[model samples]
Target: MPTPSEDGNASATAPTATKCDSEHTPQPQSVCEPDHRRSVVQNVVLIASVTLCMIVNTANLTGVSISLPTIGRDLHIVEDKLQWIMNAYSLSSGCLLLFFGRLADLYGRKRLFLCGCAWLGVFALGCGFAQNEITLDILRGIQGLGAAAAIPACLGILAHTFPPSTIRSIAFSTFAAGAPVGGALGNAVGGVLTQSTEKSWRSAFWFLAGMAAVCCVGGAFSIDKDEPYQLDDRRVDWLGAFLGTSGLILIVFALSDGSVAPDGWKTGYVIAILIIGVLIFALFVVWERYLERVQNGSGTRRRRWWTPPPLMNVSIWGRANGKLGVMLIIAFLQWCGFLSFSFWITLYYQNYAGLSPILTMVRLLPMNVTGFLCNVVVALVVGRVDLVILIVIGTTFTAVANLLFAVIDPAAPYWAFGFPATILAVFGADFVFAAGTLFVAKVCLPHEQSVGGALFNTLTQVGAAFGTAISTIVFNAGLTKASRKYGVEVHGSVANAPRPAQLVAYKDAMWAGFAFPLCGAILALLFLRGVGVVGHKTGPKVVDSDATTNEKTVSHPWPTLLLVYQAVEDR
Candidate 1:
């Protein structure tokens, strides 16, 4: 059954159509936006706060890769346990995102957003002071919980407040640009900070914690607070949240652990966990459908705790905007491609190419430069052209780039193969990032915007976690085979071990890395083709409050402008 938000153009359409006589209807008391100038100031403050937070979060995630050797040496971390430092964060964040996202909708977004950042600060600080590997791993997981809450809301806030197509497009382009840009900057930051004789790996986490603390304070002031809006005040579904979160966590956990597990897929525990996770996910779907039935029969017009009707509405899927999901998936695949290769290429540069930690950082600069520039280029084009075409073009180039990387032999020169590969992959991902965000922004109704934004961000992160995990499994499997064939044990110091056969093993592992981007390109081509539409072209320029009847009469989109003043304020 369609709820108020699900219908997309019922009660909400009335006020938008009925123009204020400047006498009959009174404006709601403003929480933040009073004049255009104030609104612009508030928006800039909010964007700056969120972008800084994103950079810190990303730096914390990636900086450890370079510092891992120093950390392992100090903590006496075994070869098998090293990955957990990374997995602890990824698993927690991916699993908890859905629950936290729904909570943001039910409660106030600003409240959760602030809370998430505060918690991130605490955990990041704890991670820096940890004395043992287990302690660090546990602290990292706590840090991820905070990130899960904060990251999704960053996009949600923008989507809900920014109703203008042009402004929203630019906002998301900036948001998408933060991750890769942050990553590049993070690697450089990590390289510089960790380059000491004191071996100060702890400084990375401390830096993250300090940055998070500052951002959280600024964000708290920037956000406008009001009486929290409720979708329906439906009872929160603990059972569904539990099942969904646990299922995702376990699946990611199993995959991340697969590299260390003896016998790989043959291990009983791995298979069992994988099977259980799938079953739990299936149960979550069934439970959501059951909630839908119960709510419909109870004569409640509002959506229930699970499966918010706006997102589940079949009609949205048929719209050109719905193809945004397909494009997002492509974006997911491209990142997955990058992560898969990155996990191996880090070794390639160090082991085969004989580059130092600092040199590896320097060499990857081309990729980062291209990615950042491409994002700006895509954002410019989006203000004028079709998002679907931009995404397809990006994915096409990205796929070709991955294929190029796949064929590079052991003797391939850096300029001949590696440099071009970096440029191509960065270009592909940058285009997809900008275009996909715009597509999602255009499709969603105002009230349902948070969930839409959450889903969009969630899928990309989930894909990254999944891709990284899967590539680890593939790399390990290839290493195990190479180890057996060459009559060497695959145990101990993978990053530092120098053996002729081990180099071959690492190369073989990288060979399997090409499959992710290839599969991603195929998925994008198949699912997202022919989804272009002319948006905001024929629609009313601005919603007026005096023509409620007229607003409902036209088949045009009903822009929910009740609290959208912040988005229109000139930046």
Candidate 2:
């Protein structure tokens, strides 16, 4: 059916329409999203709003590192407790992201995005005023929930608003650039504030809070009004949400906390928690599978008063010629190397070499420069370059970066070793992140954009946790062996240990860390090797939730704009 649209064009009435032509013959109202609903200036603002928010989000992360020492001193917190200040934020954010992402797709992305900003503003304000260690840690954890709520929705809004074009590519690349720049500012701003006045570390939180407020207002004014999902499609998968959130929290907490515990992996509670989390995740998988089957009418129905859809369908793994699932694993693996290099680079400058905070930040400045440059390059080369080649480059760079850091010379010139490592690490991250994000957006069902974004982000976060934990284990083992050989306390009370042994420990960890990206690179080479012409179905399948019959199809990719490297040919 064709309807008379406001633009005096025949628009398809069915939601099956994926393409639009505001400049020509388009399908439906979704096509009218950016050009028809928003002006060019508004589009620019929309991109800027998401970009600035990304900067603020990452700034909050690295900024905390700047103030941690001062915060420890002012609050009389022990050294081990400082990890919580950072980990709490990551834990909460990682655990809740998927749930919030699903909500964004179901309800409204714009609404969720705005609320997240305001909520973040409120709690970030509280974090600044917190007087005690426990209070601050709690506030930081709760504050993380804001990011979980907003990130998926924010990404969803972009995917929804933009048609597949160079503009969307630039938007994502610009957004990627913000992360490293924000990280640099986090250190710079927190350093500036902490150095300015006594007990001024708290000012960092206030700065972030104000930034959140600004992002919220800017996004509200700039982003287009969201088109709503169907009433029947707006069901919440409550049971799946509970299982997913709890399982993720437990798993991440165990992985992260295990490295820091006194007994490390041998700790009884940590082991138990890890097992429990793994089991819960398994259960979540089964539950989702069942729900999806039921949703498709393959199973008995009317089991409950309301049958909500699966928060994430288990069959998502089988989509996109199974490249989606394989890439998820590759992305996770590559990020391990990426996160480790970023983490160890700062530690190398500070803990290993005893550089001051400001000096350490200066040493890492190349990362910001490279990240910005990498994003620009990504925007230019992305549809033109084979995606697998870009991923291979990214993984190889990270592996090399980690290896360089592992063998870094204390007396080496910064340009010879440190600078290259910093630049390579950011380049790797930006390449993978930008490409991976765009791929997920393209493959996902239009309604599942937020959930897809959440899935990608969540994997990267978990990868970071594993990277940290695995590196810590290696570092600890190296220190223990050194202590045994030297017959001293090299493994314990690092300040009391031989400095050489501690340096060896850090090197050992970094050496082990490089293996992750090496694995990623190999996998990328083997599986996601090159661009191929996208396969198409003989006929389009109607989007039906309750359809029971599973007709095998030649291909199943959603027919969105070929925003990436896939070539389109006239049939």
The numbered model that scores best in lDDT is 2
lDDT of 1 by residue, 306-332 (tens): 544322322333334345456656767
Task: Indicate the TM-score of model 2.
Answer: 0.83
Which candidate's TM-score is highest? 2
Worst 10 residues of 1 by lDDT: 553-562
Q: Could you estimate the TM-score for every candidate?
A: 0.81, 0.83
Residue pairs clashing in model 1 are 17-547, 17-548, 18-545, 18-546, 18-547, 18-548, 19-545, 19-546, 19-547
Poorest lDDT segment (10 consecutive residues) of candidate 2: 551-560
Name the TM-score of candidate 1: 0.81
> lDDT, candidate 1, residue 278?
86
Off by over 4 Å in 1: 1-45, 76-81, 156-176, 296-325, 351-354, 383-388, 400-405, 409-413, 443-447, 491-500, 533-571
The sequence of per-residue lDDT tens digits that candidate 2 reaches over residues 1-571 is 2332322122323333335534533333423345565678888888888877878778777887756666776887644355567667776777677788667655677888888888888988898898999999899889888888877666556656775556766665566567878988887887777667564888888898898998898898888776555335567878887787678678767876675677877999999999999998899999988876776666355445456777777766655656667777878888777766766666667666877667777777777778778867776676557778888899898888888878988888989888888878876687777677656644544444445667778888667766766676677678777766677854233555577787788788788779998898788788775433122322222211222233221111122222222211111
